[model samples]
Target: MQKSVVVLAVLAALAVLSSAARAATDAPAELDLLLRGGTVYTGDSNEPVVGDVGIVGDRIVFAGRKAPAQFSARRTIDATGMVVAPGFIDAHTHANADLHSTDPRKRLNIPFLTQGVTTAVIGNDGFGGFDIAAQTQRLRSAPVGTNVAMYVGFGPVRIDQLGEANRAPTPEQLDAMRQHVSRAMCDGALGLSTGLFYPPQNFSKTEEVIELAKVAARHGGLYDSHIRDESMYNIGLKGSIEEVIRIGHEARLPVHVAHIKALGVDVQGQSGDIIRRIEKERAAGLDITADHYPWTASSTRFSAALVPPWAVDGGREAMLKRFDDAAVQERLRTGMRENLRLRGGPETILFSAGSTKYVGKTLADVAKASSADPVDAAIAVLRDGDLMIASFNQSDEDVRAFMKRPWVMTSSDSSLGHPRAYGTFARKYDQYVVKEHTISLGQFIRSSSSLTADTLGLKQRGHLRPGYYADVVVFDPARYAAKATYTQPALLSEGVVTVLVNGRLAVDAGKPTGVGAGQPLLRTPKAGSCT
Candidate 1:
């Protein structure tokens, strides 16, 4: 009787296991979207494979060599003759201000969308905002149209606490600044960013920055900076790079150099040296990375880039007084001449925006038109208000050299009056990867996507994998190219057929679908665990 009971129990258990297997095989994959017939280039891989991607409710449910037989979706996009890859992420940007516009059309960020970017890291140059919580809340209250990750800017914090004073922060004031960083990190800011090259932040000493960086480090955040000097300015290029490395080492955090460049005649051909130093630091176990735009020209306001920092000290009123004082005029002229020379002369600086008549004219042309010294012409333009200039100061060779480094990623450093704002990524892909062959397509995608995500400590958003957020791009490789030029800065790029952010279509059939599918990405201290 006992033997009979044991045999009966074993038979029952086998029947139950068979039923469970049947249920698993018979169930349908309830996918919301399916992209079929495409060459999938997973950002982490060096090769592409033909496959289908299945998405359901803001997450990828399936991505493999073949589509799951039982999977079906409400919408299916035919991706024939296209390469589907993870969405591009811009490591540095100034589009936060533009996205904050009251107009929804402007907020959609069509320029970025057409270039296949779904995410952008903003608040660069240490001017993101002082109150990061309020800034994020404002962004969340409206439709941002694209994914945004913000940084706590040290510049605004200094301005708020010290009122543009050019002195070392007192201990109490330094603690107050630390509090600001802590608050920002708690409020979901990605990290702390400093524009040590700009006012207020430039006034701060390295010790003060190190302490502030510690606060971000404790929260597992990054230290991103526009270094104090990129050329022949105070501290020099190598000194500035060393300063960043010192901070990262002391603070125990990752350091990201914004728009890494070899600017001016003084720093040309120094890319090899820069790479060696960075590699040495990495070998010593320091986490250092950098981003660069593809353009030889860098855009900035005339006052900030050309005017002597001493002239701008104490604020705009003081600078204006010095600009007008007869005694100081010669001194200013002497300084401006040197500045113009360091920036490759007046011929290299082009007026990109602000004054209609001066637009597209070089500084040399503008100086000649006014019959004034180029310095005087620049001062006149600045006197009207801040004006934009696209300074052609970098070497193409240097740009390519820095780009090939494994630690560097792509960034637009995008703002108004520059073609880079619209065409940076597409231009990199077309001009550098396709035409120049500086890096392979896989390397380009990796640098533009997964590498950025890893540097930023972003979780599950930069790869095309099951269980990851569905931020995807599909483009025709042969057709992908940048249309925007210096003369036509707002023109849209071509070849991106579709872009999905968080499983929602932002760009459909090469055009914006008018959907605001962006969410503010908040970084927590435990974010790395998710990675």
Candidate 2:
């Protein structure tokens, strides 16, 4: 009897031990995935550092300090020594071209993901191509490395309704344009963007823009503009700014200035005045916002650099005819000289998407070799291709000044144009935030993630909170840097190890896992934005 009692006591002790162990490691019921380790900047001022983030289905349920007791997940990621923040939000992009021209997801998204960007806003500078329904349909069907939002092309809308004439639309045409805008918004455009600096859009006046913006506003969308002037041209610097501010007031819609800049050494130190205008307006509750790339060089088409807008009035065929005309050619050269001065110098210019042979060469070199004037060299390149070039016109002082503002946010100003498109986020971290120490890690994270997501009204995103979307990035902060340059724009960024979009692993273990798990960010009626 004594021996039997001893064995029973031992067995009871064993059962108790097992029960205690289970209590300590019990799984939570709501989690499909769990991320544990390092530090999490939740973007929530309250509980920024959470030990574990619990995911249920697609959304996060718990993100505070905890171990799973009643819950179990199909997968758990050990994210020790990583900073999991919201995915970087690109404020402006031409990636819309990417979706239509090719399978958007099949390309090298590694450069973007490696820098922790999971969402890119496409359609800027007033141009998004035809066939909206088909494009959105493909975006939904195929899947992509990041969430993509689109904007309707104001330039195309103008062209489709009215040719490239320098006049306001007729009352009937205006109504038709409104209908087109309505259809585009219905077809899932987040807002409207106008490249007013370009030909067709430049022809439009401020009143017309206000009218178009009213259409966007009615559908709960914002108006974003590549302003009519970035230099001391016909409208002048102050005039261009007033245009946007006036639109905000006149149309009662949010206005976003796309790639805001005061181009040329002539206006180098005038950014402060622009900032003051924005601040004054913002304080008055005017919905105004802007974004800037970290680099000093601005990138765009070569045709824009050479030919006068008037000559390009009839589109490519007419423009080419004028290009062949000697008198028009003289006018083009004169315009190029004036424009080139606005763009710093030829050496500061770096060619991007063009004949690969001309990619890194400057206008000076190309001009010298071709035995032609630099302007003529640029025109020739454009004749062969609508080559994208990066003009280094921005000042370091101005960039730093812009960064100092709480209102100014970071942007790549990058399209699939070149290094900026791929290397923007990495460049921000490596060049400005870490290497230069211009901003803290928290500031950098906020600028790239939460601040950006908030601007777009991404509910429950851009934070490391429980019940938030599981869009996360893991990277070593110290080693992060951009590798791509004018010479090689396709080079992937370094230091990012893992990236998740809506609980799906688009990038994992420093490699793309072949997941197209991004979701469309629909426009909320009250919080309209540029897609």
Candidate 3:
């Protein structure tokens, strides 16, 4: 009897082993890459789970608790003690400046890649080109380092139809403008972007924008705007918010606020009010959202910061002509003085780019050195050339308030001489997520990735789900931080250990791989819209 029992046990054990072998053989083939032992945020959850993520070709094959024992990979990254999440998508950027460069190195987009941004939206603040197909073709021919999506800019379209004119467009011109927007939408533009805060776009009335926005809406595109006023410049911030809501309602399209902020002392501490207004609009069923960078200072042309919009109506030469007009001088100065006061004071504006002599100085410093009034010094600087200034206008309280909102996403609004170009994501993580605990890591990742993607209609990206694109980021949370500052704007971020764009490593072991794996992401127009 004992001998019989032993034989039965031995046979059962062999049967179990054979079943396990069959299961292993039936499992999917080896993965192309495996990220082992990391805290993973799937971009859909506000909580993280410690797990392994497996990829095959250009798609994620597994992204949960330990990838099965049967799964293997050709390349494996020991992601121990790291945070693995979907690669961040920048809601707004000026990366097109470099992406369009002839030099391959410039197209590498190392600044954004090092910050773990695998995709960036271009043509923001109303500057995208009208020819979406031409732009896509150029990007395809000379690939860039990060995926590029574009908006059909209101500024370019309006300028093309009306040459810096402040008056309303003629009916023929309006129809022509509508055709331009429709063609761009059919050619894969995400939406219409307008920097209404800047001239000549500021010259466009709300009704004109609504007409164009309607064209984009018919083709299933959204409206993105740098609202007409972020401060008390024209209509107040609240009025601008209402304007955006009205546009959404009138045009019947979603509206996105770009780099939303309570700029200037006049609008300081009004972020709460702005948030309430946005929420009210949202509750009223208008599709409205906004993006913000993680800095108190806002960057823009020196002239845009101080010069009255009416003075810049025609163009540079026209504006220069006004500067020489004795009749306009006192009025210009008066307007500038009020603008300067609204933006804190002369000391709060730092000249970031343009004249070498003034690049590192404040408006106050320049005024003092020139022995002139601050306004006069500003005019002198503008007359020479418009410099980029970093105006320290927002309060931390307002910044945090905007950030805490679930509707607000992250953006760089990147431009030359601004640290945000290199470090917006990292800075947000370091300051808001890590040190201050203003938001959880998962919240930060979600806002920077999936939220932006969903809002902008970027398909098949920004998540860590099976069958999703393998654009992933692995970083040392403890070490991940922004190294760039206003003075050192070009310094790269630190601690982004590995980055993959389209399943290829763009940054490996914290060093860029020099692989331009980026592709132009063109939105397909609604069915039959192209035809």
Expressed as tens digits, the lDDT of each residue in 1-531 for candidate 1 is 653343344334334545446346655545678899898887879688898887767777656456656556789998877989999999999998768888888888888988989998899999888577787777788786779889999988888788877888788988888888888888888889999988878888898999989988988889999999999878999999999999998998999999999999999889999999999999988999999999999999888888888788888888888988998888888888888888999999988888787888998998998999888888888787777889999999999999999889999999778999899999999999999999988888989999998889888888898667889999999999988888888788999999999888999998899988888888886444223
Give the Cα error of residue 342 in candidate 3, in Å: 0.7
Best of the two (1, 3) by lDDT = 3
Location of the lowest summed lDDT over 10 successive residues in candidate 3: 6-15
TM-score (all chains, Cα) for each model: 0.94, 0.89, 0.95
- Rank by TM-score, highest first: 3, 1, 2
Score residue 332 of candidate 1 by CA lDDT: 86
In candidate 2, stretches whose alpha carbon ends up further than 4 angstroms from where it belongs are 1-27, 46-50, 64-72, 101-108, 129-132, 326-330, 526-531
User: What local distance difference test score does each model get?
Assistant: 0.86, 0.74, 0.90
Using TM-score as the measure, name the better of candidate 1 and candidate 3. Answer: 3
The digit string of per-residue lDDT tens for model 2 on 1-531 reads 653343344334334555466467543344456777756776655234746776655555556456446656678888777776767778777665454446555533555677788877777788864345666777777667778777777888898878987778999988888777776776667778889989888888888878888888887777888888887655866688899999988888888888788787678888889889889999999988887787777887877755667877877888788778887667777887777777776766677776787877888888889898777777787777777887788788787777766656667766544788778888887888777888767777777777766766667778766556778877777677888886777888888877888877777778888777776675655434323
Reference-based lDDT, residue 148, model 1: 88
